[model samples]
Target: MSEPGSDHDAPQAGREPIFMLPPVVTALAGIMLAIHLATTLVLDNVGLYQLTLWFGFIPMRLLAPDQLPGGFWPLLWTPFSHAFLHANWEHVIFNTLWLAIFATPVARRYGALPTLVIFLVTSAAGALAFAATTLPNVQVLIGASGGVAGLTGAAMRFIFQPVMVGTDPDTGQRVLLGRHLASLREVFTNPRSRNFSLIWIVLNAAVPLVPALIGQDIQIAWQAHLGGFVIGLLLPPLFERSWQHE
Candidate 1:
């Protein structure tokens, strides 16, 4: 059943086969996992620390450039590099799972090349967002959450409506197509999308409080999540709109 103001009764009608993931989704997930495994299981502590220091997005390094070893040069690449690093197993697992769920549809819609671009671009945007909030703090921000969040936000623009794949000649009915991209107004106006966005924002914003309540020294990086999501919500159209109807 559809909500009173929802655009559709439910997502496109179809039963998806198990692991019906696009190649780009599968490949990216595998790469994240492999890198995490190597960093945790293969590399020694010193090596891991060095790698993290070099690759992780550190706000202090960029804000107070003279004190850091690489100076300002690292800023250009760290935004993109940090997406491939994770602070722990839980972090990588969390990101990979979300990536599988959200990125699958996007990869299917845009194919491998464009999907990769979206992930990297949103992640870079996320790094900047994180930096803006942290200012002078010497903290390492590492995870795929930014890019995965971006994919989730991007999906919100289209995943709710029925897709027209083609005619079922024998049954004389329209088939469920791949992912359908919706307009900006459609995404904001749809009840389902609105509720989804609200829930996501609330849950993410509340994450920092959880660790605080328990006295665990953990930062949730909600700033990066918001940054990626906003960009994801707005950016995909630039890559897709031209060929969307084709």
Candidate 2:
């Protein structure tokens, strides 16, 4: 039954499937796995360390430009490159799962090309955000969490609302038959969105504490997550407003 006064009460009725995994997403995730295997399993320790040093986002390198082997050029690429690197298998698995969950909808909406752009921008933004919080040389950021977090943010734009499809009155073609884009005010005002955001923020912020409690030495890059999420949230309005009527 429809929840009280929910507009999305109408059951989904259309030829277009609501959700499906795009090959792009699967291929991207597979590439990440392949890279992990190549770096960790195929390469020797020295090679892996070299790869990490070259690709990982080292705050120290940015903070101390003179110390950088190739100078500022590496800084330009490290932000996005770091997304393809993970510290361990657990890290890659965690990030890949989240990527699958959040990125699928976005890739569906924007297709592969724009989705790739989103990944790069959010990944870089996350790295930059993390770097801002820490002192130079303190940590080398690596992982797809930032990019995945961005996808999560983008999905929030329309995923929660019910989407309807129908023929356009003028064009006689299928058009957006769903709720309009949620305004910024609406996003904050809506209980579901507000609560989800709150829970997500709190959980990520609390991750660092989990290691301490569990007696593990692993570091959680919560800073990167927050940064990427923020980028994801903001990016859609600019690029995806057009898709609202699609």
Minimum summed lDDT over a 10-residue window in model 2 is located at 10-19
TM of each candidate vs. truth: 0.82, 0.82
lDDT of 1 by residue, 98-128 (tens): 9998998777777788789889989988998
Assess each prediction's global lDDT (C-alpha) against the native: 0.83, 0.81
Candidate 2, number of clashes: 1
Error of 1 at 132 (Å): 0.7
Off by more than 4 A, model 1 = 1-19, 165-180, 208-217
Q: In candidate 2, which residue pairs clash?
A: 60-137
Number of the predicted model whose lDDT against the real structure is largest: 1
What does candidate 1 score in Cα RMSD to the true structure? 9.5
